[model samples]
Target: MIEKHTSNNGLRIVLENIPAVRSVTIGIWILTGSRNETNLNNGISHFLEHMFFKGTNTRSPQDIAEEFDSIGGQVNAFTSKEYTCLFAKVLDTHKEYALEILADMFFHSSFDELEMEREKKVIYEEIKMYEDTPDDIVHDLLAQASYGGHPLGYPILGTEEHLKGFNADTLRNYMKEQYIPENVVISVAGNTDDSFIGKIENYFGSYNAEYKPSNIVRPTFLANTIERNKDTEQAHLCLGYDGLPVGHENTYSLIIMNNVLGGSMSSRLFQEVREKQGLAYSVFSYHSSFLDNGLLTIYAGTGKDQLPLLRDTIDKTVETLIKSGLTDKELTNSKEQLKGNLMLSLESTNSRMSRNGRNEMLLNRHRTLDEMISEIDAVSHDSIQKVIEKLFNQSSSTALIAPDTSG
Candidate 1:
């Protein structure tokens, strides 16, 4: 069973003690990400994420890295569309040390002006790197089109101009306002006990102020023209449509549709595009949803010569599925594959730690493994068809990336 507690200051902690597990996994999840930024503030969340490691009041930057390296422990962090997370996995004996280090990184980081200036150059290079890669750029173009003018449509990495303008005072203000306990949660798994819970309270329980999340109004969906023209050899293609958010009843069914559409090698897109026609090297579909909005995108990379035929093939696949629907065998197989993947993830203490945190922050409840397996098992072909029709209708947005190979 997973234990949950909330401090008077609104700091929520979830503990799942796995006795036989040899290490402890500790994580801190902050609710701010790209979706929460303003135009001037875009990418600041990601930039701030990087700055957290520079140092803290009690730990120098090198001290932070070496503390765990000396323990044969693993430490890392990432920023995504919805949240930022920092985690560490170390021997059970070092549980308190891990928590203390994590807290210092989160609450007391010194965002030096000198360091921020240097990192600005690094982030600008990162922007150029994304532009140089067709695969990365296509996804960026897709999001830009999917959400249109919404902040959610903007790239997670703020533009080069914005990064140049960021400074320490600005970053410190952003952190003070955006990274707060009212919008944060911590998840831990392995070698946990009441003492572990007590230590968490001692370290983090004091930050429990009633901080309100910033208010930003986003549109329900976007229906506008989106096209990107780049000088590349192959035309990148993407189409966006509506999807259900993560906790919806039909979310699992949409996951199945995505699986069959492009998720696995045995999927329809792979078999049709790669095996039968050999028209493209890669093609797949994915379902993405925010707290209230969602997007289902299909991406393909092919030459200008194959553009017409590629579109036709993709359209044909969607039309066929909407009409003929999925077979019981396909549905059953996809579910099993998904279930197996889910179960496989539980084997790692790090994966479990991150899952336990993100799930609660997103769902407000922890679902048992059996409950998830049963949900996957219950999806039927008829329901799958209904979801496809709803998601792939004509009212979707399309964006593409291509090279000027003719030039």
Candidate 2:
């Protein structure tokens, strides 16, 4: 069972106890990310996440690292399009210690001038590394093609120019605007009990910030095609189709549908693109659901000479799926696979904490295992057909990174 509580100041806490495990994972989730940023601060949310570990008012960066190492705990943080999470996993005996350090990082980060300059150089290298990976950066190009000039199209790692301008004031001001109590959730999973809630509340609760009503503008999906010429051996292609938002009633249907399309080795994209045609080594599709909209992305990488065949094959596959829909066998297998994946994920404390944290942060609700399985089983052919039609009714946005034609 997942226990939930709302603190007096609106910080939400979710705890799931797994008596079989000897460890606990705690995550601090904030409902702010690149989507909430402007062009000027396109990467501040991610930059701020990096700064949290530089040092806290009470602990040096090395001290923090050594403390966690001494306890054999793992700590990390990441920034995504719609949210940021700072999380830790440690033995149950060290749960309180982990929480305290996380809280200190949250509330007392020094954002030292020297550290800021040093981290800026680190992020500059990080940006360069991302630029060097064509296959990886192609997805960011897809976002640009799909959302056009919207903030949703912005990359999580802001530009080097933008990163240079971020100082202590910039971080604090951004936090004041985006990191309010109502937008925060503290998630815990493993051998801990509800008593741990009080300790979390003691640290995170009672903090007050000016609560400004949310003014997030929903992004409009565009079917624009964006192509980049790079000196590369393979052409990277991505297709983005408009899909449903988070917690839509047909979410299970879409998941099963995607699984049949390209989510697994037995999937059509994998079977047809790689096994039979030998067009590419990597081919897959995934769905990303945001607060108000979603995107279903299909990706394939192939030698420059085979790019045309790869595109034609993908188009034919999508067309066939649209015309004939899913086979009953495919539907049944996908549903079972989804359920199995869910069950296997519950075996890990980190997965449980992440699931609970995201559920509470985005949906503000949790469902039982039975309820989830029931929903997955309830996905029917008609429902999946509806989702398929809904997702592919319009032309898709396209992004491609191919060898330079100038040569």
Candidate 3:
């Protein structure tokens, strides 16, 4: 059973009770991330996520870690392009303790000056680590090529210069503006009881309810290619096209179309490019949907000499799908594949907590498991073809990292 409640200050709480499970996963979802940042504070969302674990007024960082370890619980957090989440999974008996610790971190983080300085160095090293990985950095380049000047294009990990500028005041000011009761969702799933809501209310009910409307300019897609010559062995590439935002009617159809095109190991790109031609080792397609826009991207890593062949194969595969569409067998197989994956993934308490939290955060509503299955099942051949035609006809932007032969 699933239940939802809203506190007087506007904090939304969602709970899923699975009597069969022995553990519960609780998540505090905040509606702010890299997209809410400016050039001056590009990576503050992620930086702040790291600082949340450093300490609170009542506990030191070591105390926080040791407590979770003693309880045999798992605690972590991640910052994305649109939001941040701090979450934990623990035995059902430890629910109150888990929530109390999270509440303390959320309400009382001190952001010590020395800790902030030390964390900046850690993040700087993280940035350097990502820069050294061409396959990883290519995706960031693709975002820049696709969105250009939009905040969506900025790296989630800000530049070293920007990181150095963030002190206690900078973090506090940003948090004051972004972290309010109205901008959060608390989700708990698994072997939970009716008392969970009251516990969440007690911890988070007193926050100020403030809404700050964002004035970010929506990004326009630019069809251009960017390339960097490196001394690496494999040439990494990402091809991106404009896609639909979340909750659009055509999003489901697009998912089906993507699956048949390049999403699965049995997908056309994987079969034709890697299995048949042996052109590339890693090949797949994925779509990212944000509040106002989306991106459909295909990625491949291959030998520099095989780049042209790989590109031609991908282009041909897309053209074939557009012209001929999917066969009945292909459509049925893809739908079942998607449905099975969805059902199997929800068996975990963590997945259920994430799904409930993200749905409430992004769509402001909950979709039952049956409703999602119905949506995927209702996708028709005509709908898939239409989405394919619309998506494939658009101009695409490409980002490439190739080995430099000039040396």
Best by lDDT: 2
Name the TM-score of candidate 2: 0.99
Worst 10 residues of 3 by lDDT: 209-218
Candidate 2 colliding pairs, count: 0
TM-scores for all candidates? 0.96, 0.99, 0.98
lDDT string for model 2 (1-407, tens) is 99999999999999999999999999999999999999898999999999999999999999889999999999999999999999999999999999999999999999999999999999999999998988899999999999998988999999999998999999999999989999999999999999999999899999989888888899999999999998889999999999999999999999999999999999999999999999999999999999999999999999988998999999999999999999999999999999999999999999999999999999999999999999999999999999999999999999999998656
Ranking by lDDT: 2, 3, 1
Error of 3 at 297 (Å): 0.7
- 10 residues in a row with least lDDT, candidate 1: 218-227
lDDT of 1 by residue, 1-407 (tens): 89999877787899998898889999989888888888888989889988888888777788989998988888888888888888889999988888888888887888877778877888889899999887777777777767877878889898988787788788877777777777788899998775687899988888744466568675566655556678888888887887887688888898988899888899998899878999889888888877776888888889888988998999898878888888878888899999999999988888888888987888888899999988998899878887988886757677877755455
Q: After superposition, how far is residue 395 of candidate 2 from its true place, in Å?
A: 0.5
lDDT per residue for candidate 3 within 1-407, as digits (tens), equals 67989999988999999999999999999989999999889999999999999999889999999999999999999999989999999999998999999999988999999889888999999999999999999999999999887888888987999998999899989988888888899999999887889989988987784577766678899887889998899999999989888888888888888898889999999999899999888999999999988899999999988898899999998889888999999989988998999999989999999999998988888877898899999999999987887777888999999997455
Give lDDT for model 3. Answer: 0.91
lDDT by candidate, in order shown: 0.84, 0.95, 0.91
Which pairs, if any, clash in model 2? none
- TM-score for model 1? 0.96
